[model samples]
Target: MLTDTRNSRYAKLCGTGGKDVRWTNGFWRDAVASCAKSMVPQLEHMFEAKEISHVVENFRICAGEAEGDFDGTFFGDGDFYKWMESELYSAVLLKDPERFQRLRAYISLIGKAQQPDGYLSTKQIIAAMHGESARNKDINEFEVYNMGHLFTSACLYKRMTGEDSFLDIARKAAGYLANLYDQAEKTGNVQTAVCPSHYMGLIELYRTTGDESYLELAEKSIRLRDSVVDGMDDNQDRIPLKEHKKIIGHAVRATYLYAGVADLYAEKGDPDYLRVLHDVWHNMVSTKMYITGGIGALYNGTSPYGNFFKDQKIHQAFGYEYQLPNVTAYNETCASIGLVMWAYRMFLVEPRAEYMDILERAMLNTNLAAVSLDGKRYFYENMLRRAKKLEYELIWPLTRSEYILSYCCPPNLARVIMESAEYAYAVSEDSVYTGMYGENQAHFHLANGADFVMTQTTDYPYDGNIRLQISDIKKDGPVTLMLRIPGWAERAEVTCHGRTETYGKESAGSYLPVALSSLEDAEIVLSIPMKTRNTIANPMVEEDTAQIAIERGPLVFCMEQPDVETESLDQIWLDPSAEYQLRFEQIDGRRIGVLETTAFQRKIWNGNPETDPEGASNLYRTLPKAEFEPVDARMVPYFAWDNRGVGEMRIWMPYRTR
Candidate 1:
C-alpha cells in the first residue's frame, strides 16, 4: 500500500502493490531505473562526504563514529531522510540487493545517534556534545520537522521490510514528542512549526503501529498552534487552522499544512475542515495556480500583517488573486510536489476527479521537470517563461544545477519518482480504478478474497490508447472497474469483452463505472484520441490574455528558443489555421514528443508613427505596423524544454484568430 490508508473511511488509496507490483516500462519506470544508476549514487556520495553535505557526518559525529560539529543546513537532516526513503523505494522497485545492506548500515547509525530518551535531532544531539541544551533553541532550526521525517521513513522501513530496528528508533523519537507536547500543554509555550511536515508523518506513524496515542500526538501538534504568539502568514500560524480561510504565505508550508490536516481529517472526518480545505483549494486553483499545474507564482511576496508584526515577507510565496507572473514565476520543485501530496489527500477525502486531475498535472509536468531525464541535475524553481533579460529579480536563481546549496528538491523529487507507481493505479476491496495509464503488471485482491493478475500496456502522455487484461481469477461475478476520465479529455470510449461504451464531455473530471459480468480472461481497451489543441488561460490572468498554449494528451508544450526559428518570443505569433505535426525527438537518451507548426515573426518597428523617423524609441510611443515573415516553429513538451540548454523559453505565445 502506497499510503496505508486502506482503513481510511474516505480515502481511495493504492489498495494494491505493496512492494510486489512491477513497473515493466514507462515514464515512471524509466525514472526509477535512471534514479538507481544516476541519482542515488551521486546523492549518496555527497551525503556521506562531510565537506559536501554534512548530513551523515552530523549523525556519525553524534554517534561517536566520527569527529565533527553540526555543519549541515537546518533541513539537512530531513533531506537526508528523504534520500533514505528514495533509496528504499528504488531498491524495492528494482529488487536491488545492495540497497538492503546500505539500509542496515544507515539504520544502525541512526539508532546509535539517537539519544536514550528518544530525542534524535542530529543538530541538537551534536549541540549537546558541546554542552548546548536543546531548550531555548530557535524553532526555525526545524528540529520537529527533521524528526517528523524520521517517523515517516522509519515507518516505511517497517512496512516494507517487516523490520523494527529503525521503527524502534522512531518510537523513541515519537515518545519524546509525546512528553514535549504534554509539557508544552502545561507551559503554554508552544513551538511554532516551520515548513511543517511532521503532522502527516505523525499520522503515518499512528497508522503503521495502530497506536491511538500517536494519533493523539498528531492532533496535539495542531492544537498547540493556538498558543503561538506573533505568528505570521509565512508559517501559517497567524490564527488557528479552523479559522484559516485564504491560502497565502509560503507555498510549501501552506500545502504541507493542508496535507497534514487532511491526514488528521481522514480518521476524524471533520466537516468544517473539509469545507475550509475546499474553499482554499478553489482559491488556489481558480486564481493563483498555473495551467501547467505549478503553484506558488511569486518568488517573494508580502503576506497579510499588521504594523505590530515584524518582517512579514514570505519566500517562495503565493501572491494575490490572478497575480500569476510568467517570466519570474517561482514554482518551487517541492512546492508543486507538495501540491501533489495535498491533492492526493483531498482526493482521498472526497474521491473527486478535479483533485486527481491536478495531481496528475503537477506530477507529470513540474514534478517530473524538477530533475533531468537522467535524474542527475535539478531545478529549484520552475519558470513558465524565461528570456535574456529579467524585469523581476528572483531570490533563488532559476536554472538546473547539479546540486544547490539547499539540496532539498533533488531528493524530494526522487522520492516522488520512486513512488510514482502508487499514483498510477488505485484499488478497493470491490473494484479497481485506472487512475493513470502506464505499462505495468500489477497484482490485486478484490471482492471474495480473490487475487488476480492484471497487466496494463500503454505509452501514455504521448498516446491515448490503453489495454488492461486480467487473468488467474479465483472467484468473480460482475467484476467492476472505475475509469477516471480526466478533466482535460474531451471524451473517452472503453471497449471490453466485445462491449463498447462511449462517454461524452459531461463525464469529464469524474469517474465512470463499468461492470463486467463475464470476469474471467477479461480484456479492456480504452481509446481517447490525442488531439493537439491550442488552449487559453482565463481572461483575468493578465500574463496570458490574448495568448495561447499548446497541449496534446496530458503534456503541455513550450517553444524553446533553440527549438523554434524565431528572433524574439514576444514578436512570435501563432496562426489559428496552422497545421501541426507530431514528431519524436531524442533527448538525453529519451524519446520526447515534439510539436511542429508554422508561425509568423513580426519585425521590429522601423519608425515612430507620428515622427516618421528611425531610432525614436520611447516606452509609450506609437509605432508603425511591423512587417511579418513566415517562420517554422517547433515546440517541445514543457518538461523537456530546459533540458536542451539554458536559453529563452516560452509557454504562451501570441495568436491571431484570422
Candidate 2:
C-alpha cells in the first residue's frame, strides 16, 4: 500500500480552514449558496412527498407490467445516487455542515437498504428478484460513472472534514464491487467492465486509510481497463469497454481513466503504470489537446478520434460533427479540470516542474475561463473563437448540447474552485514545495510539532513578482523551501532581506530552494522578468505562416474587439517589432494592462477591378496607420475576456514585415 502519512506540501495551504484566494475561497462559498438555492427549487419541483409517491408508484407499475413483478427497495434511478454523492462531496468542500450531515443521513438510509450479503446496487437488486427483461425497462444499469462519484464523495469527505463515515460507506461499496469482480475472475466471465472514476476514489481511500485491499482492487480494475483498449484496437461494431490508440471515448471517462492510472502508479510505484501514463499523456498532449489545455477532440461520444486540433473552427452547434469543423471545437470545462487533476497527480509521482506548469496553464486559462465573473452560470464547452450571433446568444458549445441535464461543469467547477487551496503546496520530509503563487496565507505543522507559516502577496498572472515571508521556525536543523520559477520566466531575481543572493536555477520549471535555520520573519522576493515576445506555433500547423501571440512573464495575452476598435479584427495587421506602448488601465472596475500599436488604411472592394494601377480607391482602417498615434489599448486579464460586451477576440494576430 502507498503510504502518504508524510505531510502534504499543501498541509499549510489546506490547514488554513479559512477562505484566502478568490477562485478557491469565494467560489466555494458561492457554490454552497448557489447549489443550495438551485437544488432547493429543483427538489421542490421534483421530489415533494406527493411527487415522489407518484413517480415511485408509476415506476413500480411500469416495472411490474414489463416483467410481471415488482421488488421493494429498488429506488428512483441508477444515476440519481451518483449525482447525490457528487452533490454531497461538493457540499463537503463548501464546508456545508448541514448538507454534510444530511448526506450522512442519506448514506445511513442507503446502508440500511442493503441486503445481507452486501450486494447493494439498487438496479441489480430490482433485476435479480424481478427479471432480466426489466433491466433496460428502467434507468437501472449499474453505472460505473455513478460508482466513481460515490468513491469521490467518500475520499473527499475524509480529506475535507476528517470524517470516517463516508469512508466506511465507500469500503462497503468497494467490497461489493470486489466480490463481483472476484466471482467474474474465477468464472472467466470478465466482460471488459471497468470504470475510470472509481480509481480516483479507491486511491483516495488508500491514501487516507492506508488500506492494501483497496490498492489491490484498484490494480485489478486497472488491468480490466485493457478491455477498453482492446475494444478500440479491434474496431468492434460497438463502442469498446476500453479504447487503445488514444481514440477519444467519453471525455470525462477517458480523463478519469488516465487519472486513475496515474493515481494507481503513485500508490504502487509501478513503473509499467508510469509508462502507460507517459504514453497516454504524450498522445493526448501532442494530438488531442487544445492550445488552451482543453481536451475532447471529437463531439461524438465525447471521444478522441482524429486530427481535430488542426484549424480554429468554432462549431457552437452540437451534432454528429460537433467535434469536427474547427469553429465548433468542444473543449469541455470538466476535461480541462481533468487535465489539471491528471497533471497534479503526475507532479506528485515525478515531482517535475513541467507537470505543475501544465497545471498552472490549465488553472489560469482554460479552467478559470470556464466560469463567468458572477460565478452563477458557466460554459460547458470553452470555444477559442466566437461568432457574433453565438456571442449574443450567450451560447456555449457544450452547454447548448442536448447531452447536458444539470450539466457537470458548474458543480465540477465549484468543486475545483472550492478545493483550489489544496493545489498550491506540496511537502517532502524536511522541505516544502511551492507550486503556484497567489495572494494567500497558510500555516503548516510539521510531524515533530514544529509550525511554519507562509504569507504570499502578489497580483499574479498580471505580474510575476512574488513576495514570500516565512515565520515560526524553531528547529536547529535545516528546513528547505523550494519555490517554483515558471518556465516562461526568462530571468528570475531572488533576494534575501533586500540583498541579492545566488540560488541555483533548476531545469526550466523545477523549484529552486533557499535554506535557513531557526529563521523567523525571513523575507524573500522573486522578480520574474516580462517582455513582449514573439512565438511560433508548431510547424505542422502551417508552413512559412507563423502566428504571433504576446507573452509577459508566464501569462499569454489576447487581442479583443475593444482593443482593435473594429467589428472585424481580421483586417488589422501588426508590424513586426512595432514600437507599441504598454500600460495598465481599469476596465469594468478591474485593472489590466493593454498594448497600443499602429493601424493601417485599406481599400474595400465590392468584388470589382480597381481603376488605379498603383493606388486603389480610398478606404481607411479604423485607425489609419499614419493617424495611429501611440494610444493606450487596454487588455483585460486573459481569464476576464468575453466578460465585456461580446466582440471578436484573437490571441494570435498576424504580423507583417515590410
Candidate of highest lDDT: 1
Residue by residue across 1-658, what tens digits does model 1's lDDT show? 5466877765655445447466688766776788777888889988998888899999999889999789969888888888898898877876888998898899999889988888888888888899978743788888888888888888888888899998888889899989989988999888767878888889888889999898899989987887888788788887777887788889988998999988888878888888879888998999889878888888788874323346878888887888888888889989998998898888766777888889988988888878888778888988899875655666666678887888888888887777777776676666777765678888777644656778888888888898989887766646578878888788899998889899888988888887877578789888887888889888889989999998888888898878765545766898877888999878999878798888888777433346535443445666666677788888898888677777788889898754
Stretches off by above 4 angstroms in model 2 are 1-142, 191-195, 227-230, 233-250, 301-326, 388-406, 447-449, 473-477, 502-507, 542-545, 575-633
User: Which 10-residue span in candidate 1 carries the lowest summed lDDT?
Assistant: 605-614
lDDT of 2 by residue, 38-142 (tens): 543243234223323222232334334223233322333323343354455446445677776766665665555454654445455455665563422322233
Q: Report how far off residue 581 is in candidate 1 (Å).
A: 1.6
* Model 2 Cα RMSD, 1 decimal: 7.5
Clash number for each model: 0, 19
Judged by whole-model lDDT over C-alpha atoms, candidate 2 comes out at 0.55
In TM-score terms, which candidate is top?
1
TM-score of 2: 0.75
- TM-scores of all models? 0.96, 0.75
